[model samples]
Target: NITTDTLTIAGAGLISTAMSGDTLTISTTATADQNLWATFNADTGTTTANTTTDTLTVSGGTGISTSITGDILTITTPALLNVVEDGTPVLGGNLDVGASSLVKSTNVILSFSSGGEAAVNWTDISTALTGSGPIIRSVGADTNVDLVLDTKGTGDIDVSTNKIVNVVNPTANQDAATKNYVDTTTATTAQGTLADTALQNIVEDGSPQLGAQLDVAGNGLGDGTNLLLDFVEDASAVNHIEIENEATGSGPIIRAVGADTNIDLKLTPKGTGAISVADATNYETNVTADDDIPNKKFCDDTYAPLHDTINAQTGTTYTLVLTDDGKLVTMNNASANTLTIPTDASVAFPIGTRIDVMMIGVGVTTVTGDTGVTGCARLAEQGILIGRR
Candidate 1:
């Protein structure tokens, strides 16, 4: 097998100036200024005389059997092509790779790998293939597999490969809260414009469902599920998000819940700080305490009693301890007895002053008044009791 050896040009990347199964060293040095070019095996160890600034040509190499005339090289044999690294073998006519030919292929399958360590990040390619943006699939008239610019439609020749084209029209009320999707469309729908707005703008554009809120769907749900226009309030404030787990061993599946966010929160009684009872103390919850109130309770101290009683006395007792204050009297005796109020040098009470008396013993207790004193105006008694002027 005649294998083509690549000649390394002085640069940062692996670029070949020429390749052939021969001992060839292609090197370069800095020239002040000029575009540099080279020909492969052009001389064949023997130089040809080109007297003027004219075209030079190279002859056959490896899998190609050719002869150079003027500036063009023509293949003289039906060639067998092979991809030296990892790519589809390209040729002038139809590529014959081993026993297979790309002339009448319905589709071509390709995979990218970088030394089994990383994936080949496709940037530049040979002249045979070209395109860009929004993963596209073009079903041409011939329908033989080809990724050409503007392959899907007569629109802009988008060269970006990482894009999605609307292959079918999305169904109504089927999902995405009824958002238009590129993969669901039946025509050349520019998906980047629709999805670039993000989920929020999409929801904000449409009317929400009856008593429903728009939320990002999380958990195992696909990107499409994020558009599930149904946002349900989980509790008082939490809203769940739907996304995929992307966990190993689980493969790539849509999860129904990712996480949540809180809306608003409220307190119980709607007051700041706390209200608590102090030890062995009560609070005047209705009003603020004043000087007369002092906020002190009976448990701390007590006041003097307001009522008093004197036992039976043998002699007549007329002068009351409180001369001006009103008094009521009740008497009890072993036998018939009376307590009398004598009149002499006694300061008369106010006109409204009245006395009352009662006898529990078997004796009459009458309330008799002196000449200056008025008789009992309102009194209840059983015996002659005394009243003063």
Candidate 2:
């Protein structure tokens, strides 16, 4: 049996009792005036008439039951002193992050509140603290404990200061153009480069000329010296250096300007001579002017046929020499002019020479063929005569 506001001893001992605010004063004798009650050996006391309103108090306690789900550390069994904080919790003593690991669950947030609402909520630092952070052991401790350098996603962890500071960004990702090299953007590939064409770029202070963009000529990145235009290949490799007109056709001639124009483009060879044309006489070490073409072949360059489109009235005789590649000769009779030809011996045209006679004049402009030559004179009016003579 249990009772409140009274005390009873198991052994034959005197009991004393007094009522206070929320404390019951009981003595070993029934004298009714004892402030402090101390339990002695072999003395078991009980209060009868028990109800749920009865209270039991313990003075000092340790190793009480505790549970932790996330940051809310709850005490299941009451401790000797239970402190609850409805407002801001003021730490009266130093908080020791004990030797145990301060582990945090995934995505667990540590929120800072002001005026009952969270002003700033820090997202998951579990990986940042545990993963990247280091561990240090004390002088005599068994294991190590991690000292987290709160590595938020915004900045890098400052190793020197052992804290998370802003990352020192490379020249890229900066809005200004003050950097010499951008570490962010990648270099551009050639845009449909010709097999023989070389690439070029312009630069200043080791940076690209046009920031991160390529020019119209598809020349980007560092200076043109970054890549040289040296043509190199094996014997069968027919490498050509061509000047482009645009993306589609040929452009202006690429010429050596200023004082450099006088220097000859001397091709150093392996077995024979300097520069060869059509496998003919190979030139020696130096050319004619040491720069100019040394007696080029009698064949013409890649140019159109050179002849008079008008009639030949001033000259008494006409002469033509047949080249390896053929030529197109146009003879238009001018007004009132009769074109004459010399004898077959004086005019000496090759046997396979092709003659084109086109009469475009309204007047009767007569043309005399080679005198003393056994050939038929076939002339057409308002037409072109094409035959091999």
Candidate 3:
């Protein structure tokens, strides 16, 4: 049972006490530090009657500090940062160190690691930093390692106008060669002055001229086996001689060809040597044209006749053939007999061909001409003689 004036509160700046008919009430006052003290008292609310007084302590951690004056508590924080040694600190903004260098020890190497991969050390090669600039090269101990410069996606490594010098002489087919190596090797090998002269003579000269005697050692001049060696005129397209080598089981051929249909390939022998064929057995058989050559057997049987051999014709009608030239024909028929003379197109008797005809029987034999036979009036009138003049 407490009256309005029965309850008393000594800390008037922090709290206020009031009584209403048998109940008591304690409340926080409106002050600057009211919220701080209210939270502190609420955290330590368990208290008994006549208990020991509780002390509210405010301490600092790392870069923070706390202080207490007459009735106020002060928490002091540092202006600079002091991070823990073992913790990873993430900065939301840029960390700029003004006018100071970030230094590392000589033995410590800077590396890059990404995507949970092992870190690779930077600048493994030793560089000479004096003179013009640094010469990027391999280190002393790593003699076998190669220095490769790779480009990113479709990018090219351009050297601009500079040349890569001091290259070694190439031994492989695909290796790069230096200008000095090419000049030195060409001068000493077979491709020297003589080859240059030969190539220049062939390409620059208009006439057919040779610097030296042409020698076909093993290979031929034209296209290889079974090809033609054509000798052409400079202006004429149709006039040429094609000398062709035959394939297996055939002889070689030399033919004259031109726009004229009939052309002759004449071989005039030097110094009275006769035009002779080496193969005597395989002679030219089909002798039809005027320029055709007759073999020995055909000349002996057809043209050169035996004077004493007489061809006795017992039939009534007899025709003169090519074999009848330079021979005597005797007609022996009981009835009147007729001896026919053929045209030059059928039998092709040579000029000055003579055939002697005699009437043996009592029948009077008369010589006649075929349809196209001309200049045979004397022979057609008299059957005693038949000649082609």
Candidate 4:
């Protein structure tokens, strides 16, 4: 039993007390669970074990100072941020490293490595390739292959041999000859007995045809027909030039386009008021009573044989006189001798026509038995021009 007025507990914080006369017993087994103090009075209840053990632990609460066991909290500075595992961590978490930090499962395949030391910085291609060892290539040819180079550090580049290609350069060679070409070895050379003799004779006679021999048909020469006469436009066709002789009141009309119904182009009438047209029905005809134009006389007989119009001569002196003022005469001497024609010597010949005077005298000294020397002149009175010896 204990007797006291008041009881207080400090340090260990345990107390038991009773009123001045009331009995108080000290019991170690029973105690209050708080920081408390008790007072006893004469008439009040007895007090025992009023002060108790400190049971307000404050382990986890809003306003409390808590500490962890085995943790060195010696008022250290704040820590830097640490990368968390799968879960995100705030700024002040400890940097804890577990046993197998970065793990790839046994059954899983990893294409690339992770968590290695950073490579050294380098610029040269040889340095980079050497450092990264052999890299694994896709092993097959891919059309859209990409070349990825390390932009940051040294690394190797792996390429497939299938990606290589060959570059070809163009060259030229001689090919087959074309159609118009005459291959030198295969082209034919022409030769004939009679033809060669004829060609030699022509050359000796100073008359080699060569390529200049005119093609009678192709060149429209010596084809036995005049090319102009064959392609003559019909006089009756529109705009075709038509020749008409319309004399003013005369003979069975020379020729005309009827009386005068649009006779724009009319030929001047000839003398005698006559128009001897080949056909009277084909041409509209007329006549002029007194026309002054001369009527050209054309012989119906074919041109005279050139030999008949020519006469050979041996004498030296010859005189020529023009019968008509407008008549023309040509004397050609191919005898290789000087020819002198004695005109009045005062009569000046009109221009435009030629008066060819040649020398066909005895060849200075005549060569005996020369057939060509028995001279004769050649001429064409009308059309058949001839050369005579």
Top lDDT prediction, candidate number: 3
* Clash total of candidate 2: 12
Q: Which stretches of candidate 1 lie over 4 Å from their true place?
A: 1-311, 314-330, 334-345, 348-358, 375-389
**Tens-digit lDDT track of model 1 for 1-389:** 23777445343222223335654433333331222335332222322223365454556666557776676768876645545563554467954488773332323333222444443332222123456332334332343545444355556755387544444444566633223554233222332344443233435566423323435475433445424333346456344433344446664432333244433322235467643324324433422445334223432322111113434433333333334233446556545544445344554455444444556555444444454645442222444333322
The better candidate by lDDT, 1 or 4, is 1
Evaluated against the true structure, the overall lDDT of model 3 is 0.63
Provide the lDDT at 85 for model 3: 59
Can you write out model 4's per-residue Cα lDDT over 1-389, one digit (the tens) per residue?
A: 25756564332223333334554554222233323333112123322443364232325344434555564432333445554543534457765767744333432222332224453222211111344543333222344444344644665454555442232322334433432222222222332223333334443565454434344675432234322222224555443232333346743222223334564655457776854555433222322244522223221111222223223334433333342222222333323322233333444344432222223332331112122334434323222222211
Best of the two (2, 4) by lDDT: 2
True-structure lDDT of candidate 1: 0.41
What TM-score does each of the candidates earn?
0.17, 0.22, 0.32, 0.16
lDDT of each: 0.41, 0.41, 0.63, 0.34
| Candidate 2 vs candidate 3, TM-score winner | 3
* Deviation (Å) of 268 in candidate 4: 48
Query: Which tens-of-lDDT digit does each residue in 1-389 have in candidate 3?
Result: 64555446443443555667755555553433333434634332222222244445679998788888998988888665566553557788987879974444432232222324452322332333356433444332344645567899999888898887778889999877887655455343333544343334335557645545668898686776565588877684676688988779998899898887888788889998987755544444555678877777556655565444578999989898888877888888778888888887878888767677777777778777889764333222224653534
Which runs of model 2 end up more than 4 angstroms from their true locations?
1-79, 83-86, 102-228, 233-389
How far residue 325's Cα lies from its native spot in candidate 4, in Å, is 12
Error of 2 at 328 (Å): 30
Candidate 4 segments whose C-alpha is farther than 4 A from its true place: 1-75, 81-311, 323-348, 358-389
